[model samples]
Target: MATEPSPQRAYRAACPNCGAAVEFRSAASALAVCSYCRSTLLREGEALRRIGQSAELFEDHSPLQLGASGRWQGAAFTLVGRLQLRYAGGSWNEWHALFDTADATGAALRSGWLSEDNGGYVFSFEAPPPEALPPPEALRVGAAQVLGRETWSVASVTTAKLGAAEGELPFVPVLERAYVVAELRNAQDEVASIDYGPASEGRPPRWYVGRGLQLAALGLGGLREDSTRELKGRSVECPSCGAALAVQLATTQSIACHQCHAVVDVSKGVGADLQHYAQDTPGAEGRGGGEPLLPLGRSGALALGAGGTRSWQVVGYVERCTLPEPGDDEQSFWREYLLYNQKAGFAFLVDAEDGWSWVRPLTGAPQLGGSTARWQGDSYRELYRYTGQITYVLGEFYWRLERGQRTVNTDYQGPGGKRLNREQTGEGGDAEVTWSAGAALDADVLLKAFKLDAGQHAALQRDVKPLSSRGIGGLAGLFLFLLFVVIVFSLVRCGRDDCAELRSLYGEASNEYQQCARNTGGARGYGGSYGGFSTGGGGHK
Candidate 1:
């Protein structure tokens, strides 16, 4: 078991602007915001100078706060300051964690950062930057960069602005200012972020390297109580239907109207006029069903090997289909359910015709080859490639999801029923790439996880076959036999009678007869085959 560290000596001073007591816990901190008057105070040796007034922090409903204590590795740390940053898509928080360590002089506080990404946490510490760091404009998405002995893939190049700041900071923050930030990742789940603020000021870029981590693993204490109480019960009226709808997650940007099935945009917050657009309900046009097997707000306990058993809830649902290829008559459809856990973050449960699988977005990029991929010492073979489009959506989502969102996907199969998938959105410099990894989940396990009744479990079950065990010849024969049976049934059922004239003209089981029967609406399940049986899009942010 881990524990927090003992209290350390701190420098106390009076705010020059407000005359309020100001404190700095870390010796390296040069700036402190006055809580009494929102004054930005800059420290010059023993003197304090009033720089400017700091902007008010946004209400992000974050669980962590100043003075929170936690353990990192074998060291104890305390949260001292925070910076709220915003990009075009959304906003996140960067907390300054001061670790208690011993120096030649005595006990000292070291500075690190804990960044909030999507719903997860990233523990990062400053690293020595390379001799020359490229500018944000020169760094392209999906491109590779080499640092020392490691090769990293560019994950994102965002133009982010400093929204607000609180508590003590190591460096003075330029409030409400825009700067370039580039993130890179490797195959080992390590992430590196380059801040160009220093470079813009005629200095080398500052690099911070770390990996995705769960909050529970940090052995944190003094977390905010009832962290989600205020946001969870918030409600707003639907603009389209005028029905009251509850907004569940604070990070949710879009939600669907259950009354009218209109996609409502809550990105501007529920306090503003909600924007909505009507879309056709999937399965209403006689296509595949769009109803989710798992109901929203339903909680389940999933046993994830070394991750242990954790409770997750179904927060969102989406229906997606592959675009019909040339000369193809029908499309393949699948549904994805968004599962959320406060501590574990987000994951997706895909329900395809073949079976169900659990997957989550990865923080690291995998090494891709011509037709193979390597990640975490495992290899994967290509299985399918297609373009998936969102057909329908319901419930809440973190991203600004819209109907007809498309992505080019490449899926791979690994050992022990594991799977890997890559989805690319946009093109060139504006492109964003995401990777997901998981394994095939059993239907019975889900049943147990959700504690479903027998009837519900039966409906959720899929007829998963061990197709790999069957030889290629056996699969071909089985396909031919099923085709023969469908043709025979179509011939007999055409025109509500045995079509003797057609049978004599094109033989008992000819292609021409089968085509005629299909054209006349006699052949069942003959429209088209589901191409490659894909996992629907959900995990990608």
Candidate 2:
């Protein structure tokens, strides 16, 4: 005790596979994945033992690296390790960030995870260890689980594999090891995840809860430069129609033929066994042959509240239909044009038979309970819940898209007739939820914004009854009012001299006029012939 404990220091050893010097920053780290040779090395005393080769990390656009430092909640943290994980859809990075703060004993270290995917970044911290965790079987999707005092709904449950690892990690990661992760979401859009490593090892699962973070908040530096520029603006010929399509984004997986309306798979790059679906022939019943009102590649400026206006190009089009459920006989459908701006992401302009709507995807999850939901402080009531089918598709999509895709849709209406739509895909525990909010727009506004030919998009003109137009009833009332005014003016002018003049002109005929007035009554007194002229007269008072 008097001599004091030796300060823990970094040690270095030569990799057995590549003979390259590898440095381990933590004295407690027993294993390190060699960055030079990607060999799994076991640190035994002062020597390194090569175990196996690790898979090389897949290329991506992430701007992060080991040894990068950042501040979070006024605490300094360093990126010490990372685990690349791949799921059924794609791959993502789970960075192990070690905080500078030490515990009471100062012997243990604390760390968190920075999960980065193509969608965005999510920062999470380990929750207080629970006395016991529910079994994996009990974690059902959409079911509620209590953590501390907050209740979270299971959003997704997926099994992912460890693709690769780097830097000094607190625990050893076995290459190609499979782990179950159950993601939970709260009403506030807060996210939590439970990582269940092999339960046969008899270790308690880990729990983490946190919110999504923007890249600017991380203060990250020394990021790898993105190489997607080389892939952008690449052209690929459609396998079905042979029309050349310009791939706008490197991340695009599928595109539709502009000429033939065929869906083509381009994930393997252009000319590499591109798979395509033939255009669906119009059936004798006349199903699935609707044309888009807005042409693809048409760019329009959209006003985004305080963000001002930005131009978005129409990149994709989908015609979706909602048939009456079960016993119902009504069928409704709508057309949705997908717009994209490289900096602003995706948006939809929906053309329904009744009206048009401009919709944008929601980042914040809405609070849903029963048939009601609250979004951005506004409450919405459920309007319709139905299954939507993709009848036709054109242009490009970020993911693999196909014809006849179906999704369960629930729509809501809020203030000013604003719409909140929730579309769910997949089934059972693997369902994914997407929320979009929009408001009704006039067809004229859309036409002017896109600068489209009004004649060509005549179908987009909705049969909207003018709110101020009261039909023939208003015209009839106006005519009656004008006639009453004319009659009153004439009576006032004629009362002064009209009766006396009639008596002077028709002296002896005055008696005849009086007789005519008496015969015709006061309202229609003048209807007899006088001096070969038919004179119309009224009763004199």
Candidate 3:
């Protein structure tokens, strides 16, 4: 125990202080200033040290992968790519680091310009903001350079379980192949974007372009299809006896039903072609810059450009729903007229306190959902004001979405768009609660609740539900139970034949439920794929 151990063998360029063996993660890996000698060894061959510059190639896929995630505020984003850089003054170098977008905690993913080369392949890269640009290591691409290779072709991988943000995002180890591009540039000032290949193999590539991709990429949901995929939702109708529909505030007075070929009155909803007007705020290129913010609750009356009209608490139009730089590209951020649509089912979250950000086809949500205002998703619970009838119902306190790893409860922004509390639903999987109050449910939230998949857009005529007849059914169940007990009692006290008949009747009733579960249509994806804008869209977005 008292004997001193032999020193470890060092590389050819051994240090004078500690002759210990050393190893680096990547050949071109950036060097950490040596603590023992304060020296930056030039990494050559197996010799670890400082690195030189060369063009780095974007692999077909990123080395970094995403983990489990929920919505952040009103948007949904996942951790997909990461790159880190160290910038001292105006110059910088990259590091072998982690770009954790899993929870969208640090720097955001900005618009990455994309272009295809003559070689039939397209490439993309996100340009970091102009903050003396930190080396790649800061974002966690890892500080390392190709010892000889200038480029890398990122290949296959081993996945760690995904729900880490709720816990610890387990790092997936990667084996990489590198290559050096002949030329490269800090194309931030140039075009920036990325492509999401076809949502369905039957459609064209889906490109989510904007300054912030998190929102631009969350395609719509609830469309179901089969092998011979044909699009639906072009027309809507009344659920009862197929009929053409119309809504009170729609620009279009009528919508026909394709299925039942009937006429349904839509004097209830808004259509895509409806001309929406907002205070003329500036748009791209210094449009609304320096414009005074439309003070909250200061909006005037709105003309729907249709026969029906409604007044709104005009909060000014938002300037940049655009995802921050390193986010999205062309035609993203825009000014929108935020208002409550009785026909459509979304809450009119008048004005976001910060930059302009627009999510498509604005839909309503309960201040929360199926419960108290607290029961709604993060975006619904704290953002909008209640309009319409208030009905008290008992539900739970949980949101359908949230941003951040489910495990590590970090600082998440609040309803006012400020970082506030943690997203932990105290109910573990059982946070069932009971509430009583009048609350307006967003049309969109109701759609999700009632399983009304499609049809009925023009007539924003809210569907109604009558009380269940299950109460009468419950009394019948009690009568049957009492009879069965009496029969069994009499059988044991009297004859064998009586006991046999009771057993036979019980077996026949259990098989009915097993038959109904086979044809139910439902969501197949944790988030399903879209048909892209090409195939008339799966109506996803």
Candidate 4:
């Protein structure tokens, strides 16, 4: 078992700009921001030099704070500093964690980073690249690259800016400066990122590798008390309508005004200029139904097998649709409710025309090849490929969202009711790929989980059942009836290729083909529906 090392003496200095005492816990930390004056200070030997002014962090009301302690891999660590960064979509935080462990020579303490984006978290440590890596502009989503001794798939390539800094940081942050970040993952559930600090600086890209972090298992302490209560108490006046809209989640970057139905941008915090945009209300023409079955703020407990059961509340809702294909005239729409748990982060509850499912963005990328995808030890077969677009949204979201935001989606069906969905957004080097995995949820199970009343359950239940559920007797009777009709049709000289056309058009596995076979006095079979919406962004990749 791993162990935490004994506490060592720390180097103390006075801030050059603020003339306040600043403490450095780790010998490796090169810079520190004065908590009193927000001065960016650089350490040279034993003296501190004022570099620049560190921007104040936007009020995110995050539960994790400086001095918070947690154990990872049996080693204890403390949250010492944070760096807040913003991209085109939204923002995220990388909290510096100074480990209470020593280096190989026992001369210095080690450190890692606790990344918090949207609601997801990952603790990573800096590592040396096996070889020279290409620039961020050369990495494309879904493409494979060799890193170190393993091959990894490019997950996301984002250009972000340093928005703020707080507490103490290992390096000085160029306030409001832009940089490129590229993320990659392997089949072994390892997530890695390459950070190229500001293009103008010409600094070598730094790499960090780690796995998904579960806060419940970390045994973290010293978190902010009543963080949710503080978030609930905060309200901001809508720029478009004068109505007060409450920002429910501490990580909320985008929220829709309840009164005017306009989406508000609070990425820079409510104190900054709040950007608002007009959008049509849900249930409007061509956008499908707007209201969600599980209303926002509704709490429920979900059992995710080995992941255990956790209570979640609906904090955000979105309506998405797949427009008609080249020759198809019908459109398929679905609803997704973003469920939030204080410790477990976020999960999506998707309600499609087929049925219901609960999915969460995966930190590790699954291996994809040809017509199959493999994750962990399970395998999934490709089901549907389509283009999905967000048509409407309600409540709060962690990323900047706009109407008609589109992505290319491919869904896969796995054994034991498991499902996998992959969504790719943006173009070329700017593209981002995200994967979500979950199992099908029965309406009755959800009805019980949410503790909904009879009326709500009745309205929510879907009539999607497999033909095998009808029992042996009912199947036998139906098969005999179909055979008799086929014989009668043959005797009447019905067109021989009448049913063949449908089989070719809709395919044998489709619901349309099964329905057509039943209606035309033929025998095929009906199966439960499969597939889900492709929701990308916000989640930590």
**lDDT of candidates 1 onward, in order:** 0.72, 0.63, 0.22, 0.74
Each model's TM-score, in the order given?
Answer: 0.81, 0.70, 0.18, 0.84
TM-score of structure candidate 1: 0.81
Worst 10 residues of 3 by lDDT: 528-537
Clashing pairs in 4: none
Candidate 3 C-alpha RMSD relative to the actual structure: 26.1
User: Residue by residue across 77-140, what tens digits does model 2's lDDT show?
Assistant: 7787888886654456888877666534476545678886533467888776444667667877
Candidate 4 residue-wise lDDT, 1-541, digit = tens: 1233444648788888768999888887888888999998888998988888888787789888888887898888888899988777667888988887775657678888888886778888888888998887678778888876888988888888888888767777888877888888788877888988787888799988988766777788888887878987888889998899989888787898877778888877887888988774213221123356787788999875446888989888876667557888544556688888887777887776467877887887788889999998999999888877665678998777765677788889899889988888777645778788898888887788888887887556544343243554776767756764564343211112344566688776566655544443211111122333333323333
TM accuracy, model 4:
0.84
Kindly report which residue stretches of model 1 are placed more than 4 angstroms away from their true locations once superposed: 1-9, 102-108, 198-200, 268-274, 282-289, 325-330, 427-430, 464-541
lDDT accuracy of residue 389 in candidate 3 = 10
Which of the numbered candidates is closest to the native, going by highest TM-score? 4
* Per-candidate RMSD, Å: 8.3, 23.2, 26.1, 9.1
lDDT of 2 at 407: 74
Candidate 1, residue 503: lDDT? 55
Model 4, residue 533: C-alpha shift (Å): 6.4
